[model samples]
Target: MADAPTDITLHQKSKILEVVFEDGATYNLPLEYLRVYSPSAEVRGHGGPMQLVTGKKDVGVEQIDPVGNYAIQLHFDDGHNTGIFSWDTLRELGENYEANWADYLKRLEDAGATREKLWH
Candidate 1:
């Protein structure tokens, strides 16, 4: 079964997405990191090869709008915001944060990429 988020909040100033689960676990996800890992075809691609997004260290969320009751539409400062982040997806992200983040860091290290700001 998939975990569900109990509450969700966006901290614009800090560029962080906070999610609270029913188990009382809270996760703080950075906007830049989210943007880089967007599920949209523009970022993730469709059927063919996956495109790796680079040089997104300074990217931030320009706006976040509700997409019905299922998801949220995030607008990025870099003009890329087709990703509809669903509650289920957010919960999954929260659950797999450590593994996903570690993999991201490893990819960055392998590509010689560094984030401009630190995410906590």
Candidate 2:
């Protein structure tokens, strides 16, 4: 696993989360993507079925709280604050962004939903 984030900046205007890892890899992750891909059990179920979060076109992160040296909890504008995103998870999300995004889009299509990505 790569090192944890050395820095994290929230761009409220652009609704982006900029994370710089200790391994020198940085990622500009969308707020919506983070919301949808939250590691919370509410979003990701205990076992089989997972939830399909939707209608988060303009969701923004309200706050970010650090967890015990392993992860960070994101407080989203929609009142979601359970996801504990670890360094490894964040890095994987950055590395596999393209595929994950594509899969998200495909899931939306499969569910007859809209992309609903906020454009600024």
Candidate 3:
């Protein structure tokens, strides 16, 4: 069976998604992190290299809708609501948060990018 979260809370002020798994593990995922690493084809790419999503340091999740019993669809404040985050995916993100975050930062640096939202 896939790992399931026991509870999920969205702390809007802090822009953090708190996920508590059935196994007693809890992950506090920042909205920016979630947005940049969204599993949607737009970010993950369609059978190609994953896209480097920048300028989302201030992104926030506006809502979360369940997808049956296995996953959830996250509605981001920036109007991105396509990524369906599965239980396994969330678990993996929680488990590898540090490494993943570090890798993301390195990738951004290598590309001469910044997380700061660019003004129009």
Candidate 4:
């Protein structure tokens, strides 16, 4: 519910994105984490069951660029980066990381997916 980001920086080596908001809130999001949790319909789908994104444990961020003033474009090293994460959405992701991660873990477990295979 805070303001949008004013600046965004990507640390490619560390595979992390640092976003600074106008309200002074900042977030450091990992590439692997972001890839697995992309907001794209290809990842989330339009309705019904959500597509479980696997094999993203070791995916690195290839590029990070601003999309005007509303969102950011992320390119993954694995050649799977068509998702544009919006500022508000990014903030929500940062704020709900723990809960969302837990849910994702549960979903993965239910889908018989493992992070080990994702990295390999």
Candidate 5:
């Protein structure tokens, strides 16, 4: 069980979701990061290796819908609304942001992919 967020703000201009936990820990999670690392079964398979999501560098968060008192569904501009980020998952994502992001980057590199797609 994780402490609920004391505050949650969507910085529309910056495309970042700022969350402050009860323990005085705050995280400015980027929309792209959240979109790529979505906890949805689409991104994370039911089992085995998770899928790699790409071409979401300019994606925007459309809205946040509360799911009872346990999680929140992030509606993305890409029309993705399957992931429900629970309090504990959010805390883990925030706490392990650096490591997770590094791993994602390395995976992208290994796959010969770029954060953003090539422009025509």
Candidate 6:
């Protein structure tokens, strides 16, 4: 069984979600990170390659809806609410934050994408 979240708090000013688990684990996840790494099919891709989501540095979670007993549905200010974040997924994201963020930055660099820069 996975460690259930004991407390979940959203820091709107900082755009961070603080999650404390029953196993004495705590994670402060950035909203942008969660948005980009969303488990939704649109971001994860069906069976091809994972899509590189850009221009979400200012995205924030407007609401968090509980999904049964295992996951959460994050409603983003950018109108993205498709991802259902499970407890395991949240834990994994928190655990691998550093490496995953670094990898994301590298991918963005490779794709000539910027978290802030947008060109029309």
Better by lDDT, candidate 5 or 2: 5
Question: Where does candidate 1 clash, by residue pair?
Answer: none
For candidate 5, write residues 1-120 as lDDT tens digits. 787898889898899989899889999998888988899999998897888887788889889999888788999998999999998888888889999999989999999898795678
lDDT of 1 by residue, 37-102 (tens): 787888778876545676677787878888777777889988988998887777777678789778
Best of the two (4, 6) by lDDT: 6
Give the winner by TM-score.
3
Give each model a TM-score: 0.80, 0.91, 0.97, 0.86, 0.94, 0.96
The residue-level lDDT of candidate 5 at 50 comes to 89
Give me the displacement of residue 31 in model 6, in angstroms: 0.3
Measured with C-alpha atoms, the lDDT of residue 78 in candidate 2 is 87
- Give the distance in Å from residue 86's predicted Cα in candidate 1 to where it truly belongs: 0.7
Q: What local distance difference test score does each model get?
A: 0.77, 0.88, 0.93, 0.80, 0.89, 0.94
Residue 50 miss distance in model 5 (angstroms): 1.0
Q: How far in Å is the alpha carbon of 12 misplaced in model 3? A: 0.3
Error of 6 at 61 (Å): 1.0
Tens-place lDDT per residue, model 4, 1-120, is 446688778887787888888778888887777888888888878886667887677778767777887788888887877788987789988888888889888988998897654332
lDDT of 3 by residue, 17-107 (tens): 9999987999999999999999999999999998999999999887899999999999998999999999998988889999999999999
Best by lDDT: 6
Candidate 2 — which pairs collide?
none
Q: After superposition, how far is residue 32 of candidate 5 from its true place, in Å?
A: 0.9
Which stretches of candidate 1 lie above 4 Å from their native place? Answer: 1-6, 116-120
Residue runs of model 6 more than 4 Å from their true location after superposition: 117-120
lDDT of 5 at 27: 92
- By lDDT: ranked, best first: 6, 3, 5, 2, 4, 1
Which residue segments of model 5 deviate by more than 4 Å? 118-120
Task: Give the distance in Å from residue 2's predicted Cα in candidate 6 to where it truly belongs.
Answer: 1.6
**Model 6's TM-score against the true structure:** 0.96
Query: Regarding lDDT, does 1 or 3 come out ahead?
Result: 3
**Tens-place lDDT digits, model 2, residues 63-115:** 99999888889999989998999988899888999998898888888998875
